[model samples]
Target: MRADGSERIVRCNEMMLSLFQCSTEKDFLELTGGCLRGMVIAEDYRQISAQLGVWQREKSADAHYLDFELCTSAAHVRRVDMYLRRIEQDGEAFWSIRLMDANMRTLMHVPGAMDGLLSRGTFYQEALRQAMKDRDMHVFGSHCPVYFNITNFKLYNASCGYAAGDRVLSHTAAVLKEMLPGAILTHLAADSFLVLAPANRLTARVEQICRRINHFIAMPGVEVKAGLRFFEAGDTSPVTSSFDEAKMACDAAKKVVKRSWAIYRKSMSDRVVLHTYILTHFTEALQKGQIKVYLQPCMRVLTEKLSHVEALMRWDDPQHGLISPAAIIPVLEESGLIHELDAFMIRSVVKLLHYQKENGLPIVPVSVNLSSLDFFEMDPFAVAEEIMERYGISHEYLRFELTETAVVRDKGTLRQALQKFHRAGYHVWLDDFGSGYSSLNVLKDYPFDLLKLDMAFLKNFNQRSRDIILSVVHMAKKLGIHTLAEGVETEEQLRFLRSSGCEQIQGYYYGKPMTPEALYAACDKGTYSVESRAESHLYYHPLRGHILRQIRKVDASQTAQMMTFSAYGRSYRVTMKRIASAQALHIYQAKFEDITEELQYDDKVRQTDDVMRNL
Candidate 1:
């Protein structure tokens, strides 16, 4: 076979002619259309060519072997094992070919024939037979079903190539077999394995197996996770259901960092049922108005006024009472239905803004969270623009919040989306900024209008956390990116944030997420005050940095009364008092007085001098 898939019959034996039912070499060539590819069935030829292309590109191996269907002159397909070796002479490449009749049944019957494990169908069949025999001996419940998944195996294949991925899979199977000597195992699919192991010490054994696989592969960002379900005595559930439970647990394990395995529990089963209900009824829930938009007010740190409201989702499932976003969001994200939810939220927020404007109520930007799937699964920007146009809302009244994880998924698409949003005069904020390891890189590469600090920083308030949060705020300020610190529950936190020059905040410190009607009522009742656009700009003025620096330098404990500072050729008197100095950094309350006018009053200046002298 030439490199271009054309056949060159340098030598042919009589057996080859007999197999093809051809009388002479010329007849065989005519039947095959002068190419080895023509002798192969179209489907088999495509697959073989694809594999050969990969091998040729990587130059990883000299020989390739696969099972293929050869078409005879009579158009009968015969399964054969085909072997091809790359040969080069005088800078010309050729393929040395050999073929043998293959009996697939005999090949499959051999144990550990599919990458050192049983195929999916054969594994199930053998597992059933073993279950029947064990049931007869009253020992069926001694074993458990486990689902092992390679968390980022696709990345390994993409980065290291499929050949290396296959080697890892084979090594994983060998490790499983060696660790559980009497276990029944199968290669379920790409980088996934199904196993039936004895329940005794199963958790520890699975952990060892996962660790061993990781060690053997020795690749960064590649690890194994296992889910196990121990069978109870006389538990009559189908094998498929048991495996489903294991898979549910495996999914749970994948969410947590450093968690190698998880055991199936009743709670996981309940969650699975709830997930199914949510996915099935999601569309109906949206139409029936069960899925709602709730707003959490974000307060401007300098003005103590609502700068904006984050649009959060709540599912008021009648039967379930209230489905938490934590539960609902994950199910929708996994099902790729989050794009719909995001679109709904964008439309709802726009509609609410229109209502607020019509009612002569205060209108602030409503920030809606976006899932990573939105960009790939739908045109989120187009949807938002259409919704805003329909509601007669401007882009400034709505914001898009994407998490750090979402931004890291596809930088190119996200970059383009961000550019589109910015060009259209919409603000895109990086939400949960410090939740992942790639925060600095994201900030460097992407253009964001605001940074919403992850709530975890305040969840455990300490000296270290306070320092880190302040540093992030300072960095964002220097980068000309506004900052919002979430989970601000205490006045001490608010004071620290204010001193740190953080522009905005949102958390229970102001109020929890509420319905739009409730938010309107709260604003009407003076429970919350909305900041005007002019006030927002004033709070973010260039002089704010100078003021913050002065506030940070003031020793509130020692000053106690009033202090004065000069910045940008303006004299300002600021009253500094310690708010809280407990576990975290010292919180200060500063009241600035632009006393450049006071310099004209000699009597007032004399009184000020006396006060300053006493201090």
Candidate 2:
């Protein structure tokens, strides 16, 4: 083939004519329009031209081999392995070429002037064949094959729109090709890509590529991370193994802090195996009594008495012995099996309540935790009601506790359940009140019986945290809601909570969770104190301007009288006296306590009657 303006074929043998589907050299040239590009696919002409230009610039002494798709006269694409070199013939340079099929056995013999170039025994033929055999294995050098994929690709596609995701994929392809030229690329899966490059090349550049991908995607709630599996030179396994490892690495990368790329590790495989085993056996374990409820006591801070016990789930796997709830619950919740486990725990609590009642023991409130999944999976109110009915217990004995995050996630769905529970006379306490983003907002919107402060805050107990806790407690008090402190493990914490007016405390210092028999024994020993049984009278008067006054004695028939009282740097005054009296007792009542939202005062006073009636 001549590298000229016309790109004419200088000469061709019978075999070349046959391959081009022509009878003679002149006939083949005429059929191909006397242009070399006419016999090569138009799409590949630019790459081929670049390769030729590079070879010509180097003035290679040896023949260089290239694989190209050749278009024959019959319009059929032939895979051609060509060994060509620049030859100066008659002071006009042209390409001396030997065309062979990819197999290297059958020769599409071009009529070359040099007999050495055409000999099958030539070392160039062996070198070309060996290079072709290892073509897919090496990129620029004796490098490795790495499998990579964008993390959460489906999520990105769904959230960012498929068209945008497609653009991202296309942009990534172009960047990879441009940045790492000569790297073999393959699209193995929808989001997975394979690149054959030196291990060092991939390791040094993958992070940059992943960061660029993440930046380019730039969609909210859509992130991109790449995982890699590098193959050494000696690896003989199929390329799919690298892809599988890359997928595993991608999952592990999600847990890596601030990292966009991860290399495959064996621990990832172990975790995946354990997760799979747990998910497979969770349901059966629940039925086999392997999953049980553990009770933790919450005591009244002032009374030093048991107020309620939080029902916590624990797994006692036969093979694994005791599995921490922390270890299993998350997997169950993610798998949506927490719904059944929650139901089991609820029924178990009800049965325990029934057992306590039958045994003539004190039946304190048992607060069972309900996951956010419960509301969406089934009617949580109906579930609670059914358990109460099955055990023939009152709803008052069963208090439901939900995490702040759960309540905030689906306020409408949970609000309906909360309203139903309120109507049915069940107390709903917001668990881990200050552990989430919208604690105060949730407090303002949701009607909760109690707020359980997370113990995590008490771990430090610095001045700032103390102030925050006291302020939260004061706010809850002002709202007529009680606050309970969880994870209290020291006398300092218990005393601080008691001094801060926290209503309840639960922690390791009091006692670890006990079995049913142990709890029964502790209850009999008065493990919690009862409030003093004495009742006394105090003068009370309602003021018109959000105030109250206390007096030693006032006439029951007295009319409007203005009196002032001061507490906590706030002043209150009595505006009217509307009293009803017994023979030796005087009664003065106000619609609310000292702290009230005056704007909703009248409405709250009205609703209080209805709420009390329902209770």
Q: List where candidate 2 sits over 4 angstroms from the true fold.
A: 1-152, 155-163, 174-186, 194-207, 227-246, 255-267, 525-615
Give the winner by TM-score.
1
**What's model 2's lDDT at 84?**
87
List model 2 lDDT by residue over 305-421, tens digit each. 666788887778877777777767666666555788888888899999999789877776689889988888778788778878878997767888999988778848788778898
Q: What is the TM-score of each candidate against the true structure?
A: 0.66, 0.59
Model 1 clashing residue pairs (backbone): none
lDDT of 1 by residue, 452-554 (tens): 9999999898999988998998899789898999999999998778777687889998999999999999999998878765444444456556555655656
